[model samples]
Target: MSCMKTAENVCSTGIRIKDKKLTWKRSWQKYKYLYFLILPGLVYLIIFRYIPMYGLAIAFQDFTVFGGVFGSPFAGLKNFKTLMSNTLFWQAFVNTIRISGLKLIFAFPAPIVFALLLNEIFHPKYRRVVQTISYLPHFVSWVVLAGLLDVFINSSNGVLIMLLKSLKFNPPNIMTSNTWFVPMLIVTDIYKNVGYSSIVYLAAISSIDLGLYESAVIDGASRFRQVWHITIPSMLPIICILLIFNLGNILDGGFSQIFVLYNSLVYRTADIIDTYVYRVGIVSSDYSIGAAAQFFKSLIGMFLIIGANYTVRLFDQKGLW
Candidate 1:
């Protein structure tokens, strides 16, 4: 009887395994086209993102150009020690945190506010026009925008400077001013990204069930009340997710824009980890130090993401896990 019972358990387990295989086979047959569609993106990530991670090995090596990654002698913690001991690196670290924090405080909410206001617009055509105009700056490269800013705000004879002079007010060259450069970065970053970022919130808003608004209306709720009670709640999940993503990227201080817009005069205020790494690791031909800096930056970002995800989950929201 014991032998018969064991035989029955084995047969049941085999059937369950067969059933799972069949289900998976059917699922694959149904979604083969979707798999094919994602194949290119998967390939791109593997090639460009994952494959380059192998080069991080140089972070612990001397990493001479002639010796290359493999041939370079391992220096272990020497590169990290050099990085920690550098005062310029510490300055850049502080600047990166301050710049990113300022952006987070001001720029993070600009899109949410913009999207809320735009959603309140009853005129569809006007809304579309505004979106198009705002999105135009996002499509423009930072290089182009930086040049435009130079002409409009930084140049001695620039339009803004000329306008200020007409008002009998002396406007300092903000591009070179350590005090104003960070503020300039925040404002320009918002102008460049707010419209594009609003698109995500707008999408989240659209996905909200119309029935919720109807119920709110029946409850004698005004537009503001409906938005506050229903629309905002519906958007919470997406907002949390985006907040997590932004927090993860808190260390990245808009390198391309800063690199193009900043000069040696403003380096005290504008220099970030990325720019410092470029100057030290690339310009100075110290690949190991550069790699080490990048590795630490990426490590911090990863921890930020994990912590953010955990916090979001604590609020009962879905996380990347």
Candidate 2:
């Protein structure tokens, strides 16, 4: 007891039971309003995000519906081995990477470029309108947009095909073609969220000291030169931060969009882990296998997030921690 007391005294700065309780009391008193506001979100994450973690144990079991989660006999390494040997699962994984890769290559940079261009516009009313129009799509649900996209890209009555036919050119309905899935993914993602994504960059740009721009203008720097020399460089830290955040999701294939837009016609290239999980798990009633696949996806996501944070720290010396 004496030795334990001595160690505790030496480490007194660390959180002890009484100290932690007092700290919580102080924090609660100081930020009661903020805590109140965050209570709902805290409950939400706990209910939707954290609580569902119990289902993950199915990945290790036979997980029959009749036997139930706890009643199911444990079958260690069985489901995981099956996942490893499955060709279709691998194909779906590859498609997810391809779609997400294209999104990063095209969708990410387009918003930054758009934000930069908008920042340069001198017309106030036009700028606000542009921002409003651009930001609007981010609020639209994929369920609605997928139906609209189907209508707009229908081979017979679609706008693009109609315009092309008017010019004596015939283009295939790209939505159902494997060859166009990648570009479609990029274009649709960019069109939907680029405006809202640019909000961060716009905020970063606004925070940059205006005096730098004034000095650049006095030196006769052209608008393009000013943006290239001052704006992008000033925005580098935030850009890197955003890039790191994006890199952490290199495998998420935007499940809702793909599920709504895709049919077997494009499954060769369009199918992703998420959609495959739905088909094989819910439709086929293979809960164990589905849980295994989900576990793998979560593992990959964790690695990507850690790797991205590490890369950002290496380049900029700051990370989420």
Candidate 3:
């Protein structure tokens, strides 16, 4: 009897599995076109993102170019240990945190505020003009923007310096000054990205139901109150999602912009993990240490994303998961 019962259960499970496969097959057939559309992206991710992950193993090895990944001797945690003990690495790590934190504080909110202000503009043509003007900076490459900044801030004949000199006020070379480097980075980053970043918030705002605003108006709610209660609440999910993404990238201190703008004079305030890795890994050929640093950053980012998602869940909100 027991043997017969086990055989029946096994047969039932097999039937269920077969049914699931058939269901999935039908669903795939129904959405085959949609799947085909995403195939290129999937292939790109597999090639660029997933495939490169294999090289991360070198972080645990000595990772000499001549020896290659497989030929390199396993160094265990030695690379990580060296990374931790290195003063320059620690300085770069601190600078990364400070710069990223400042950007989060200032640059992150600028977009949301700009989006809100843009939404308040009643004239469509004027609003579009403002948006176009704002967005143009985002399309400009960092290299070009940095060059423009240098031209405007150059001590000898810069537009800004000339203006200051006309007023008989001497201005420091902001690009090279350690004191001004970080502030310049923060301000310029905000300027470059605020318009582009606001696009997501604008999308979120647009998705909000018009009926909510109508209902708020019926209740005699002021514009500010309506926006406070209706617009903000509706956008919270998107905001949370973006916030989580930003938290995960807390260590990425605008590598391209900083690389284009920074010099040896301001290295104290300007050096960050990405630049450090580029110098040490590609420039000085210290691949193991660089890989270890990158691995550590990736681990931290993963944890931060997980933690942010968990926090969102605790608040009874939807998360990326």
Give lDDT per model, in order: 0.89, 0.86, 0.89
Per model, how many backbone clashes are there?
0, 0, 0
Q: 99-136, model 3: which lDDT tens digit per residue? A: 99999899988999999989999999998888888998
lDDT of 2 by residue, 55-172 (tens): 7889999998888889999999899999999999999999999898888888989889999999989998999899989988899999888878877778899887888999999788
Better of 1 and 2 by lDDT: 1
Please provide, for model 1 over 1-321, each residue's C-alpha lDDT reduced to its tens digit, 9 standing for 90 to 100. 225545534544365455454465865885699799999999999889986687888999988888987799989999999999988888898999999999989999899989999999999999999988989999999999998998889657889989999999989889889999999999999999999999989889888899999988999999999989988888888888889988999889989989999989998989999999899888998889998999989999999999999999999998766
Per-residue lDDT, model 3, residue 154, is 89
Q: List the residue pairs that clash in candidate 1.
A: none
Query: Where in model 2 is the C-alpha error above 4 Å?
Result: 1-47
| Each prediction's TM-score versus the true structure | 0.87, 0.86, 0.87
* lDDT assessment of candidate 2: 0.86
